[model samples]
Target chain A: MPRLRATAIIPLLLLAASAGCSAPGANDDDAKSGSGPIKIALVDAQSGQLSSLGAWELKGARLAVDEWNAAGGVNGRQIQLDVFDDQGDPTTGTTLARKIDSEGHIAMIGTAESAVTIAMAPILKQAEIPNITSGQSPGLVAAGSEFLFLNGPTSTTYDETLAKYIVDKQGLKSIAMITNNGSYGKGEHDAFLKALSSRNVVPVADQVVTTDQKDFSAVLTGIRQKNPQVIFVGAEEVESGLIVKQARDLGITVPFAGAAPQGTPVFLDTAGAKNAEKTIVSSPYLSNDVSDASKKFAAAYKAKYNEDAELHGAKAYDGTQILLTALKSSNVATGKALADAIRGTKYQGLLGDFAYDQTGVGIFATSIGTIQNGKLVAVTG
Target chain B: MQVFLQTIIGGVSLGAVYALVALGFSLVYRTMGLVNFAHGNVVTVGAYLASTFYLTSKLPFALAMVIAIAVTGAIGLVIERVLRPLENRDFDLMLIGTIGFGIVLDALVIAIWGATGRAVPSPVQTEPIDLLGLRIRTYDLVVLAIAAAATVLLVLFLSRTKRGAAMQAVAMDHEAATAVGIHVGRSNAIAFMIGAGLAALAGGLVGPLLYVSPALGGALGIKGFAAAILGGFGSIPGAIVGGLAIGVLDSFTAGHFQGYSELVTFIVFTVIIMVRPTGVFGERTVNRA
Candidate 1:
């Protein structure tokens, strides 16, 4: 009887899921081009290790959509942004791409994970649905999808700026690197390595770890033996935080450097305030107080979510704004026209001024920041 | 030399955690003839429970850990009860059931804890102390001592106690043990409870090393399984030895080889499996009946 009940419920669950998938564009024909709510899909890792990224992206995009709706949404159509959990898996991401395209989503926001974004790019390109991703992986650009857009500067820009500050400005050349073998980590590894090589600085130790590895003791110990002046960590927030924490526990007192994820609150809290201090970060959005525009965005974001805004949130907000602006300027254009509109749209973002090129990379620069008292502060020369 | 000692200490510390987890697997498999795949998530649940009790409720860490272990053991009893109905069914059915149980536990953790990683504070100071010219955390040393003591007590319990003997008898031959008036069901329940309690204890001990998160179970679970298999599945002493060996080997390779830690460890594991189908300490007898 129990088995029979479970078997009976399985199909119902599937049916409910399919029903939920198609609900966003219920009036499909009208949503495609006619008068209807502008349907956009936000796909991200809503659960799993990368869910924090998903939460940030969702909030930022939601904030933008909410603000726009309050001020009479684009072209007199209230934008309906539906969210889908990609679970941080590329296969799930590809499946979501199909679901969103079929559901008449004009555009997509998110998949902060680079691998997922890269996996979904081809399908999204074939469907001609414009997507703005928060992933900074150079591989995302290398995917070479015209419909694919990056909300933030690529890892190349981030690491180059970081390298300049570390090797040229700070004059630290004896660097060590520890990166995971994931898409994001690989991108950072290569980009940072290239930047270091260009500056004639070779990392004394380079350790590539598995993405899911929790125990960083052995790798950190090996790096300690090298005695590098600075450690260039190229993993995500949690892993990087663990690395720093373990490094500190092992009594390695040298400062660490990284791009983007190293500056977040998750990293700060995970590593503990004392351990995360002096960690260098290169990011387009340094803090929530960079400018008056940022101050307003951060304030509004805090009011809505009751959480401090970070780089990912800022990037998502910028991307969503760019998408909405393009949609409006092009008069609710769909397909290639919308993609072109996004490419052509120019606006100032919380991160920086956005002028997207043919390659869909809008921003090209990042500023250096240091973790001071558990807060990521802009580093002044 | 200092690096080698550091690696050894780190490996032993990690191995102790794995030993606790592996014991859970060995106990369940030994007594019930069922490999409890949900044992991995039990470790996760244990960690999250300890975090809640210690961090949120402001309970003393030791008391919190005891409560966590008790709760985890209760969960184990529930799982055993659920699986009891499927005992006479196919082995594959039981295996799949345990896997499903693990998934449910994983989902439950996410639902309750909300998927964000939370830091579990170490009871001992996190700072390393230089001992014999090698830096090691006091927490790691404490874990090693606790695990060692637990293993010794467990081995003694199985060998010297009446209930342990009954459990051994059930493990050896379920029908024969039942015929001899040994309550096989009670034995199975006790084994599961103790096994799960050990896993929870492991989780509480290792929580500070790895942040308490939903994904923590899957990462550490596979290693525990590997340790159990390598040490000889269902062998208590074997589990400890296997776990320590794997930890040391992993640390040695990871410290020396930049990107080949998993490869080297697996190569050694595979070689061991190929050489000894029954594992390092597994008995030659098979009591499938």
Candidate 2:
């Protein structure tokens, strides 16, 4: 009886080992992966200062993937997601994009960071893998990559209009801008400056800091001396928060206006809710008082993730929905076909309608908003 | 004038953090004759460990800080022992090994505490205070006080305590100190433990002002090395002076230059190295090269 049990155990162990050895080969057939389940790669700042935004964006992607898989995946194939941490570094982002390209993933939905996404676009384009991102830089679409799609508004696409609104409508002048030294940072900085110049408004100071910087005292001190009416911070949520907090701490109570820097909850957390108050931000998505579609998306997302959805997450969800629609519309389309389908299609999403034009730049519903009582509330331009 | 004073205060606060990190580097270098590239990441780990524990357990800030420092000290002990395996390895390779460990530690921070930056709520009220007609954050005062007190205690221990003298003796000549009945390996372990605790304390002190993030590891580590070099490689008083000097100069430069400030800081560092190869107060050159 003991000999019979040993023989049975040996055969079971052999079977398990054999199964493990065969599984990876069956799963990693990249060329055939597109024909089977659609693969979507996410390479973002998943583990750094910017990780909060990345986490929410990925959460949105996860929701979209789950919803699609539940309702039957695109063309009866399951959606497979491969995620990597770019650490908010462009080199790391490019490396991950190359890996994704080599793996032959059908498409990628990622890189909420404008600089990282900009770095990734060329690599994904060369590999002919369609990329849908949520970064708010005009350069993301303006680069004219056939493979790149943005669910968020481009920095310069309506930047001039936003700048005009601030100058003409808000009746504020003597603006100073602080920006991160990344691709998106330079793009938005130049756009704002150009727009301000077009309106014959010149900035008091234009300061640049690297992305890893946390201290803003020196820069803020310099800016405070200028005594600008509004300080425009052209950075993301966390840095914006730190800047706002530090500025206030140094007794510089001038209100801050920015291109989406004050829109996220992170701004409140980092800067303290009181410090972030009255800071105006331009955003493509509103956290509250939105359409029924947005309401449903926010509700579903909250129930699923147990957190309030930010703008990047909404954009990621919409981008993934767009990707799913494109996937379902064509059975044998290549990555270029997928890109073309997206550029041509008019997609309604939780954020708003997205319709990419010749430049692959899409217009989304946008608004200027302010932090009121620790929440982002839309204000009329 | 107010801006100038505020800049000084800001520099002092930042420099205090640098001094703490530098002090650790100097200690590890003195005891083990190793660069201990892992020193900075230990500060990052200590911060995350403390804040995560506080966030989860709702422990008092003081108690959480103690446990966190203790844990990092234990980790330091283990690390020193583990590096023993590379006893005969080339110093450069061992240096790389320490850096490799630091990278792994940083990665572990992301894996456990996660990638998002967390705010270590201040134990004291964070309202800005008026000091000598200058507006300063209360947290800045706490940071300066803690850093100064730590420096004082370190000085007192080295000058007054038997164990501290023994460690200093080991630092002076390990073989001679061993022959004189000082336990060299034990002193080395103690040196590491103290160095790690100081780093964690620095992390805790400054974490509220600069939110705790994994990037904190790399940022402060390089700056600490600069401070260590500026103060004289193995000098305690030099670390404080060098750190403050670097911090103040950096702040003033940034206040004026804005964008070019970081570039200016590095230039100054290079200039200092060129002018004073032995550093401001570095007594021994220890020319291994």
Top TM-score model: 1
Put down candidate 1 lDDT per residue, A6-124, tens digits, no spaces. 44346445545765766454534546776868888889887788988988998899899999999999878999877788889999999999988776789999989999999999999
DockQ top scorer: 1
lDDT of 2 by residue, A262-343 (tens): 7877777878888888887777776745888888888889899788887878888998888888877766366778788877
TM-score of 2: 0.92
**Candidate 1 segments whose C-alpha is farther than 4 A from its true place:** A1-30, B284-289
Where is the poorest 10-residue window by lDDT in model 1 chain B?
B280-289
**Residue A67 in candidate 1, Cα distance off native in Å:** 1.8
Q: Candidate 1, what DockQ?
A: 0.49
Taken over the whole model, the C-alpha lDDT of each candidate is 0.87, 0.78
